[model samples]
Target: MNTLLKRQLLRGLLLAACLPGVAMAASIQALNYSSREVDYIAVENPGNTNSGGGGDSIRPYGQGGSICCFSVPEKWHADLKVVVVYQLSPDPTFHRETVSVPQYPDGKSGDIWLIVYEDGSVGAVVSLYGPSRPEWPGKIKGYPVPTKEYRDERRKEKIKREKAVLHSMENALDGDVSDLTPVELMRLKGAIEYSKKLINILEENDK
Candidate 1:
């Protein structure tokens, strides 16, 4: 082959060899945000604003809120979906939630959510929330708190016997039974018998 023809052939071969690697690199980007898993983008505690805290490296949204969007690639809606979880203002007003596209008239559309928490910790309370799961978009509702019944202080006397039995059971597992102390062992035996009876009663009730 001539000099020019030889160079052209070499370039074409190199391009073909590199095409697979280029395509794989594009796929890696999608892997970072996949529909099979949930991703979290934590934000600063809105309760703490004295530091002029709202948006920063740790928090991406503004004082108002932050949003993330995902969608099905190539317009393929089946076996693939996109999820967008967002952070919204803690304010009770202004709908105080997130909503997704194709709010209605759906046949395999993406999902969206707005999660509101005082902080990004377990102890932090979740305020206003919204969802679009198994139905249309609307405020996510929660159950009301139930009242706890009062326990009299005099009942404390009865707990001592239970505590003693528990202690004996703990010691029994340590192989410290050399000092088995018949009184302690007797208490443990009685506790075990009572517990077995209670369990039987519960099983019968369940049935």
Candidate 2:
């Protein structure tokens, strides 16, 4: 080949070789270890369309399903950073921060995880494994721990549900059942009894 053509071919080959290191699109997921729900969380590299993924309303101590199409380099770089934007429960404001992406444990990229910590801090990790795996490389290992505030909120919700059930059952029993079948009346009475027992148990526990 001519000198110009040879150089052109070499340049194309080099570009191809470097493409994987430059950027590769991958899915992103959020794991919430915080007591409060994650109203929304997004991860992106500024000015780069290839790197953007987000999910909405990840419950406290819950894992969000993966979102598509975010760039993750095949190799980690010291200067690599991503902008994480998130909102938590009881806070109307959105929090933004630029966090460095931790290196992959084995130096190979897979899915990207955005972890929401108890203190509302955000962290980034690139790994082929989920947090459930022993090989996962997150700073906080294991599943989320529910906070006291979360536990209380859950208890209140449960009580509310139980109260609603009790109310409905009571109303059904009070209504005219002259035309009702025997089986239906018996079933309703059984449900009322169970509801009473459950509510009593819950009330005793609260005390």
TM-score of each: 0.20, 0.76
Worst 10 residues of 2 by lDDT: 7-16
Whose lDDT is greatest here? 2
lDDT of 2 by residue, 74-178 (tens): 789998888887889888898877888887877878888888998888988888888878778899887677877777778778988989988988897898988
The Cα RMSD of model 2 versus the native structure comes to 8.9
Candidate 1 lDDT, tens digit per residue, 1-207?
766434434543443355432111010011011111113322221332221111211122111222221111223222321222232234222221222223222432232222333242111111112232335333323321112221222234335454566566655645666566888868767776675565455445434
Question: What is the lDDT for 48 in model 1?
Answer: 23
| Distance from true location, Cα of 20 in model 2, Å | 6.7
What Cα-based lDDT does every candidate model obtain?
A: 0.30, 0.77
Candidate 1 ranges with C-alpha deviation above 4 Å: 1-176
